[model samples]
Target: MRIRGLTVTFGEKRVLDGFSLDLPDQGVTALSGPSGCGKTTLLRVLAGLQRPEAGRVEGLKPEEAVLLFQENRLFPWRTVEQHLTDVAALSGGMARRLALVRALALGAQGCRWLLLDEPFTGVDQRRAEGLMEAVRGLRVPVLLCAHESHTLSLADRVVPLEGPPLRRREGEGP
Candidate 1:
């Protein structure tokens, strides 16, 4: 997918300014950056959850993209499975794994892009690694934001970002 000169502003704060990126057709790509640097914003744009003030994203349909947010976003009233208990009953790691699995399934099922925001937050290293392997197995493009170096290391490419007006690190963008 291609994002070119994308601009997104919140009141007076320009979260993204002339930002651009090109993602591979398939494989794992990680976005590594500090908090509040607009990584989530960029992901939202790609997922069509957030509308940018300016710019264009090519080759990705919002409906064809599924985003697993930083939070589990499981409902307290609905059961994910087993029907007896709601999703909130699951432990943090379990919830994260479930969410990741769901996202991967959607992505693999004819979806074009999968966006994950900090998907391994509560999961242990071993399980996280296994989950990373699952992410690598998907045929569609995968763009994820992760803070851990170990997690980033698993990606085919890692793009470092910085800014309220977010941009790629020096020599990192095309």
Candidate 2:
């Protein structure tokens, strides 16, 4: 997706200011920064969860994107299987199960585009690595927010965010 001179604010705090980015169509892109840098806000904007006060975003088809937020956001009443089944009707039951298995392997579950916010938060290294490996195997576009270098390396590109500005770091190519 492409964000052109986007601007966003929450009350008086300017979260993003004339920010622009060209996200690749495939592979993973990591968004990283110090605390309260608006990385999450940018992801919300891309997912249509939050609207930018001013700017243009293009090249993303609404239906094709899925977000895995920082909060589990899982229906506590539903089992993990149920959650995956709920969103995977298009992929069919078998496909959904496979996806779930993959997610569990990665310490996650439930969708493509995989907008993971602090995916490794609180998890031990071994488990986190397992989860990261699972995410890598999905072969779908991924946007991740992380602080650890190991986690950041899993992405195809790591973009550092500073308030409204963003910078890109090279990663192992597809």
If scored against the real structure, what TM-score would every candidate get? 0.91, 0.73
lDDT of 2 by residue, 5-46 (tens): 878887888888888788786787888887678888877887
Clashes of 1: 0
Q: Name every residue pair that clashes in candidate 2.
A: 106-131
Supply candidate 1's per-residue lDDT for 122: 88
Q: Estimate, for each residue in 50-79, the C-alpha lDDT of model 1 and write its tens digit.
A: 999899999998998989999877765556
Give me the candidate number with maximum TM-score: 1
Candidate 2 TM-score to native: 0.73
- Any runs in candidate 1 off by more than 4 Å, and if so which? 82-87, 171-174
lDDT of each: 0.86, 0.67
